[model samples]
Target: MLKLLIAVIFFAILLSLAAGAGFLIRDQSPSTRLLTSLKTRILLTALLMVLLVYGFSQGALGT
Candidate 1:
């Protein structure tokens, strides 16, 4: 269940990144949406890293 949740969150972050790139290409000027996406991605990445570490420590990620 935890792994599934982590995968979903990671996929969402990737989708957000793709959307932000699309916005950057379509818009004439820089927008807050892109920055917001970037910040979100960064935060999500950090969270994911923590989750990975915790999972490893708990022996949930390795055989």
Candidate 2:
């Protein structure tokens, strides 16, 4: 269940990144969209890292 939740969250973050990329390409001049996306991505990456670490420590992931 935890693994599934993690996977879902991870994919959602990836989709957000793709959307951000699309926005960056479509929008022109002084847009906060790109910066917002970058910050979101960074924060999501950190969360993912923490999830992985917790999963491993709990023996929910890895051999």
Candidate 3:
């Protein structure tokens, strides 16, 4: 359980870092910058949440 939580935390951090890189490194099209940023944030948040849920449900970790 502790391990799973740790893993999830690490994964979330990695995802956010990658998203930050994407925002920092890419030249987004003017038409899509705002949308892309919003999408990235949403996906990051959702991915973390899903990981948490799955880990907990699978008994890999306690919520």
Query: TM-score: which candidate is best?
Result: 1
Q: After superposition, how far is residue 9 of candidate 3 from its true place, in Å?
A: 7.5
Q: Can you write out model 2's per-residue Cα lDDT over 1-63, one digit (the tens) per residue?
A: 879878977997898799898988899988888888888888888888899999999999999
Task: State the lDDT of candidate 1 residue by residue for 1-63, as single tens digits.
Answer: 779978988998899899889878887875688888888899888988998899889988879
lDDT-best of 1 and 3: 1
**Residue-pair clashes per candidate:** 0, 0, 0
Kindly state the number of residue pairs that clash in model 1: 0
Residue pairs that clash (backbone atoms under 3 angstroms), model 2: none
Q: Which ten residues in a row are the worst by lDDT in model 1?
A: 22-31
Off by more than 4 A, model 3: 1-31
TM-score of 1: 0.89
lDDT of each: 0.87, 0.87, 0.67
Ranking by TM-score: 1, 2, 3
lDDT score for candidate 1 against the true structure = 0.87
> What is the C-alpha lDDT profile of model 3 across 1-63, one tens digit per residue?
556665676676676667666766675655555456567667767766787777788887764
Higher-lDDT candidate of 2 and 3: 2
Which wins on TM-score, candidate 1 or candidate 3? Answer: 1
Q: List the residue pairs that clash in candidate 3.
A: none
lDDT of 1 at 15: 91
